[model samples]
Target: MAPTRTGSKRLLHDLNQSIVFNLIMEHQAISRIKLARKSGLPASTITKIVGNLLAAGLVLEVSADESSGGRRPVLLSINASAGYVVGVRLREATITLTICDLQCNSTYTRECSYQPGTAPQQVITIMATAIRDLVAEAGLTMQQIFGVGIGLSGLIDSARGLCRVSTILGWQNVELGPALERQLKIPVRVDNDVNTLSIAEHLFGQGREADNFLLVTIGRGIGMGIVLGGAIYRGSFGGAGEFGHMTVDVRPDAPLCNCGKRGCLEALASDYGIVRTALGTDPGHAIEDAIVNLIARAHAGESEIVAIFRQAGITMGIAIANLINIFEPSHILIAGEGLRAGDLFLEPMRQTIPRHTFDARDDIELLICPTSDDLWARGAASLILHEIFQSPIYEDEEALALDDLVSQASKAQKHHKK
Candidate 1:
């Protein structure tokens, strides 16, 4: 009974601490009075919890605000330099890794190219080494690092840190989280690259204030991330937003996709597909070269190149319109490396979406944006940060005792089963 009562009290305390810390981080420079109002916690509890965080160097107090007169209230904010996390993005041809501080500021970044048929073990080794070097360069020890968050191209089971399938990498059932953890001896989080990008955009980019939005990324492959009620919607099996593979043409004559399907949106409009059509070859030079050439030709007002872009844009718009009809997100953010040619894609997409969509003028808005490679890594880091902020942090022995009790109960259950 004593142990149970102690555990209950500890759980309650940890929950309150997490809530207070999250409220401060979300509303930077918030006053204690306002934090109490927002968190529905007593002012005394908020004061005590904040003091503990400040002592741990996890939060800082900036200058006070004098808007309400009297003594200016001190404003609390997260300490951006409290710790660091590493973000790694594993793409088909390149692996990008970034070291970011608590505020999601990149302190260092490294890029490495992988051979076309690189094995998963080889790739993981290189990734681990890159992460180690980045942390060493930052003069931080392993313990100072929070964890590593990886964004990989595939159907990622983010909850388990597993890659369900990646046609590009020829990978399936890859235990990415456990593998990284084993090599690095640190906590790890993994998610689909596009989903991670959506999280990044929602937190820091175009979707920041949007309660509901759709982020469509066009590049090596097309994918989307849906944010509903200000949160990412990962459906059952963590495959909700694979919009790229959604069927657009059911005709048997349609082009085959890398996924062994015909008439998929990715089969027609992905970077590889576009380049294959433009160059008139199945196996040709790098798609990047073709894109550069296309951009130059479009800039030179070459009608053929412009027409191809226009057609692709219209197809993309039609796909988006379909998404709108179903989900009806408030804002649709078009991003990815391919957005460099947004000027060529925008007009056709704008023209076609309206033709296909049935909506009032103010229902949804579309915005085209470009993102840097670092943004992908930052998105990965945001994944870890979300988990950390939501996790209960115990500041006293009572919480530790409660955790021990829970562990013991689990062990006893296992023993009984045997």
Candidate 2:
């Protein structure tokens, strides 16, 4: 259906407002004239949009230097305190939650855990309780929250806010959005955890300056988030970032992957894969101390362990090289718990990448990002911000409606108090 003229005008206005808002965010304390020039919007449009932003308390006028001659232009900055958003990162047994203000600053965070094999309903209940409790702990009301975003490892149908499948959680066809909204009376978004990390990098992290990049996470599992043409490419079924499962080994004796495959990249190169190789190769290593002890062993010059780590790095490098050749992204961001091994592991991968990559390899920027459960949770929260701040022409209608609901709830709360 074609959009009416009124709808088209509204959308154009929203797009311009987003442009102005993004400019102000990029260059803090920017003048209205600068905004008009940068956004390519007319001066009058900038004034109207900035006036609306100021009236809504979303942006504030900062003190301008009076010594800059007659009538110094007023500079504007985003109101970081305008509202808060909640982010949740769900792991196999633990859920991390955090609250961030408008500027994506973490004001409060907490974690809760459940036993493995817990029912999905029980997990949802626990997550909702944690969110409500944490918000109260932070002295915030539901009205103050813009929305909640949940990220977990799985095949997620983000449009429907449903988990299509999650081997980590043993979940299938779970509706995260409706479930949480019913409990909390607010908006909710759910996505693949790696996708959330990619969104974070695109919006606020290293990928901000680059339009195309790959966010690869190496840990218990290896994952990749592909961004091209300035937007995430979710493939046909939203299962696109399963770079871990890509076949990197083809030998008949290759290690078995948890996905019932042999010679998969994750089977040979993930931290868990390295641990598996270590435990099976040596009889002296009987007890499991997780990846930490394995890293320590490598640091202490355990030749066998070091070799295993290097092999993992080389395998990952080969796969990453293929990724660079295929996608031709300008940057690659490596982040995950697996980084605890430090240079002993990553250096080989970095060196091997160029060896296998095609031409223009030097043009690609490689970045190593520090990762934690907190960062993952914060990345999930940034998904909501991404939905709000993205260019309106490409904005999701459902997300726009949710933002409207959030605003209405806040307005109602303020009016009731009045």
Candidate 3:
């Protein structure tokens, strides 16, 4: 059904406001004229939209900037403290939580060790308690938080808020979102750990400037996230970014992957794969110390170990090149725990990618993102913050009406106190 005339007008207003708000957020302190030009909105329209944002305390006017020609323009900036959000990275070994301001800055963080195969409900409880403790440490109440975002290793059904399969956590079809929300009494968004990192890279990291890019995380496992046409491209069932499962080598002797498949890219490229290769050479070595010792040996001029790392890199490069040939993204970000090996591991990829990629794009930019546990937590928080800023046009009327009620109640409470 077509929207009513009033509904259409409201939608247009919300869209224009979102555009102006996003422009200011991205450009930092931007002048109204610059916002107008960037957003392709008329000056009058920009002014009206900015006025609404300013009144809502979502925008702030910073010091005037030197004018290009006319009077000095007042630069607009996002009010980073207008609200806050929580991000949690649920891992097999631990649960990490971070509180971030509107600007995606981490204000407080907490982490706690957990058993590798902790039950889903217990994980939710731990997350809720950690969120509460983190908020208390930040000296903020629950009302200050917009929402909670969680990232875990798995095949996430994001729309359903379920972790359909998580080899790391031994979870299958866990209703993570509903369980967390039930305890916290707030909105919760759950997604794959790499997908959350991709969101962070898209909004705050190297991918911030590119509308089209690919994020490849090579660590204990291999995962890929594609941002096409300015949004994450989750396949028909939110399983699109499973690049680790992509078959890269069909040779009969290829290493075995955790997915019970042979010749998969992850079987050759992930940290586990690298460790598996090392086991073949350094027999009976301390399995737990395999990755650390393997990289050390390769760096110490061990030709055989270096060759194994090189083979992993070569296989990774082929898969990455194939993806580039198909997607032609503006940039490809390679990140994860495995990147700590530095150029020792990446030089081979750097050399092999160009040899395989098609013309022109062979020189595609590759950005290495050095990731840590904290960054993953921050990424989780960014996920929720991203949703909080979504244009109201996409929200159902009931949700909008509930938001209006909340705003009205807050205003009334303030008036009553006065």
Candidate 4:
């Protein structure tokens, strides 16, 4: 009973601190008074939380600037150099590793490949080795790594850090988070790759302002990440973002999807499907001139090549129109490697979306951003960063551990300096 009470007290304190911390992060150079006002916490509570953050070396006090008051207030900002984080993205055979600072600026990246059907344990071992090598290459100790965040395709149970199923990886119920944690000796978080990208966008991209939006990624897969009411909406069983699996084409002769389902949107609009069709290649055969070449042909006005992209764009547009009608999101962000086709691929989607949507509003904005492996890897890193700065009300045991890592990292930095 005593221990339980103590734990509860600690949690409340941590929650309060998190509230204050987030206020400081968002405001960047906010005064204690401004923090109190923004966080709705009492002035004394704000003072205590700020003091703790300063003492922890997680935040810094900047000199006061001009203010229309008797005494100007000092500003607070996060210590970007307080620690480091590792972000990893796992494709079917290739793994990308990224090391970023607390601010999520990627400083180092590594690419590694494995046999396509590598066992889960073998894949985890590959990740552990690459991370260790990259950390050493970056001239940082393991202690400096706050944690590792991993993003992979398919049905990821983020809360449990389990890969419920990844058609791309040929895995099922793999305890990826725990398996990586054992080797890395730090906290680990796993999420759907698209969801991770959405997290990064929410924190730093177009999603900073838009609360209700959908992130539709198209590449090896066509998936969507949903954000509603300023929160990521992972539906029951944590499979909410499987937008690519939607039955867009129901015909028996429609292309087969990797999910063992026929006529999935992924089958018709995904990179493999479109490229396979354009090149007249059998499934699983690498086309001589791949998607890039096909895109070039489309750009050159090759009628047949252009037709394939137009059809794919129409299919994707219809799917998005369905998304718009159902969710009525204020913004739709389209990203992923498929954008390489340029207007040849997207112009049709842009043109087709409005036609299918019911009462589509002029105010809804569509955002398209370039994608890269580095960006995706950074998105993975933001998974750890998200937990660190996440609102305490929504936090669970993981938040407590993340906070502990922050304190530990700060102390490690100070010890190294000493």
Number of the top lDDT candidate: 4
lDDT of candidate 2 at residue 210, scale 0 to 100: 90
Residue lDDT tens for model 2, 1-418: 1123345776777777778878888886899878887778898898887877776667889988454567888789988777789999998778999999777789999999898889888898999999999999998887778889999997998888899998768789998888988999888998899999999888888999899999999988899988887788887877999999988779998888767788888888887688778886421222235678888888898899999999899888889999999989989999998888888789899889989988738889999999889899999998888876776665455665323633554474475366
lDDT of 2 at 130: 98
The C-alpha local distance difference test score for the whole of candidate 3 amounts to 0.80
Itemize residue pairs with steric clashes in candidate 1.
none
Per TM-score, the best of the predicted structures is 4
lDDT of each: 0.78, 0.83, 0.80, 0.85
Candidate 1 ranges beyond 4 A from true positions: 1-11, 67-69, 283-285, 391-418
Expressed as tens digits, the lDDT of each residue in 346-417 for candidate 4 is 999999998989985557899998989989999999998988887555436554343585578667777767
User: Higher TM-score: candidate 2 or 3?
Assistant: 2
- Comparing 3 with 4 on lDDT, the higher-scoring candidate is 4
Instruction: Mark the regions of model 4 whose C-alpha exceeds 4 Å error after superposition.
Output: 1-8, 69-71, 283-289, 401-403
* C-alpha positional error of residue 269 in candidate 4 after TM-score superposition, expressed in Å: 1.4
Q: Of the candidates numbered 2 and 3, which has the greater lDDT value?
A: 2
The stretch of ten residues in a row with the least summed lDDT in candidate 4 is: 1-10
lDDT at 105 for candidate 3? 89
Ranking by lDDT: 4, 2, 3, 1
